[model samples]
Target: MKTTLSVLVENHPGVLSRVAGLFSRRGFNIDSLAVGTTENPEISRMTIVVDGDEYIVEQVKKQLNKLVDVIKVSKIIPEESVSRELVLIKVDAEPQVRSEIIHIAEIFRANIVDVSRKSMIIELTGDKDKVSAFEELLKPFGIKELVRTGVIAVNRGNKTIKIEEDE
Candidate 1:
């Protein structure tokens, strides 16, 4: 099964390396990882996606909790939370195809961020599936480059797995 893990850690330099090392040592491949600052300056949040058996994933979570710098960890799947990803795609576009691509992007609710005589850059943000669908729609026009910010998630209202002060 595929699982998304939201991890809160100290904003120390080596924390990310340690956490990543844990997964690497366990022979688990991280599918995607995005780390950024949260509201609190002393803390950083990481969203990681991994695919593995349920038992193994659970064990990994337990091991992660053992790390001193790791404040909290939660597995977020589709049923429990809302998840989103952001993507930027650059496509080949000239006078002939520019308008058509813009129309399609509008239908998908994507924004055109940059435009040159021969190419256009689009910004899209949505769930994984929605972003994939948009990419597919633009594939025929010729993609020049693509980049994505992996999944980020939060639990439903009024519910969350937060770090306890003592633990």
Candidate 2:
């Protein structure tokens, strides 16, 4: 199973390294990780996705909580959270095929962020499935380059992650 953990930690130097080191030492592979400062600059949120069974995930959570910089760790329930990933794909585009590619991008609501005589850079943001489908459709065009910002997510509705003292 793939588990997503939203971890809150102090925005201090080496904090990301410590967290990543912990995962490395435990031999747990992180499928995706996205980190950025939260509304409060002093804090940051890390959205990490890992593949493991329930027991493994529980153990990982406990370990994460022990880190000095860590403030909170919440397991995101897929149905209750909204998640997104951004991808930029550069595909081969000859003049004859440029219009065809543009039409395909329109169908997926993706943007042609850049264009040249030989290629076009398409940017798309959506759920994993949507992104994957878009990539598959563009493969025939020859993907020259691709970059992705790993999944970032938050709970839907009134639920939110807050420091223990705040709640």
Candidate 3:
């Protein structure tokens, strides 16, 4: 099972390193990690994905909560959360095949962020499956390079992970 954790931590220097080191010391490999400042500048949210069964997920949550800089940690219910990832792909796009590449990018609704004489950079954002499918479709065009932002997620509807100081 793949478990995703939404961790809130103090937005200070070396905080990321500490969290990563903790996971490494425990021999747990993180599949994906995305970190960004929250609405409050002093806090940051880390979306961490790891493959593990129920017991492992619980252990990870407990360990994260024990870290000094960590404020709160909660498991995100996949079905109840909305997740997204952004990918930028630079594809081989000679003039002769440029339009064909544009057509493919259009089908995926990806943005042509950059265009040059030889190649074009396309930006796409979606869940893991959509991103994977888009990458597969462009493989034949010969990918020059690509970068992806790991998954970031939040709960749907009225639910959320709120940290009450009093509690």
The candidate scoring highest on TM-score is 2
Error of 3 at 68 (Å): 1.6
Candidate 3 or 2, higher lDDT = 2
**TM-score-based ranking:** 2, 3, 1
Global CA lDDT computed for model 2: 0.95
Full-model lDDT for every candidate: 0.90, 0.95, 0.93
Write model 1 residue lDDT over 46-120, tens digit each, in one string.
998988889878887898889999889888868879999999999999899899999999998999999999999
For model 3, what is the C-alpha lDDT against the true structure? 0.93
lDDT per residue, candidate 3, 1-167, as tens digits? 89899999999999999999998999887999999999989999999998888888888999999998999998888899999999999999989999998898899889999999999999999999999999998899899999999999999999977679794
- Measured on C-alpha atoms, candidate 1 has an lDDT of 0.90
Clashes in predicted model 3? 0
Show where candidate 3 strays beyond 4 Å.
none
- Per-residue CA lDDT of model 2 for 1-167, tens digit only, reads 89999999999999999999999999888999999999999999999998899888998899999998999999999999999999999999999999999999999999999999999999999999999999999999899999999999999999999896854
Sort every candidate by lDDT, greatest first. 2, 3, 1
TM-score of each: 0.94, 0.97, 0.96
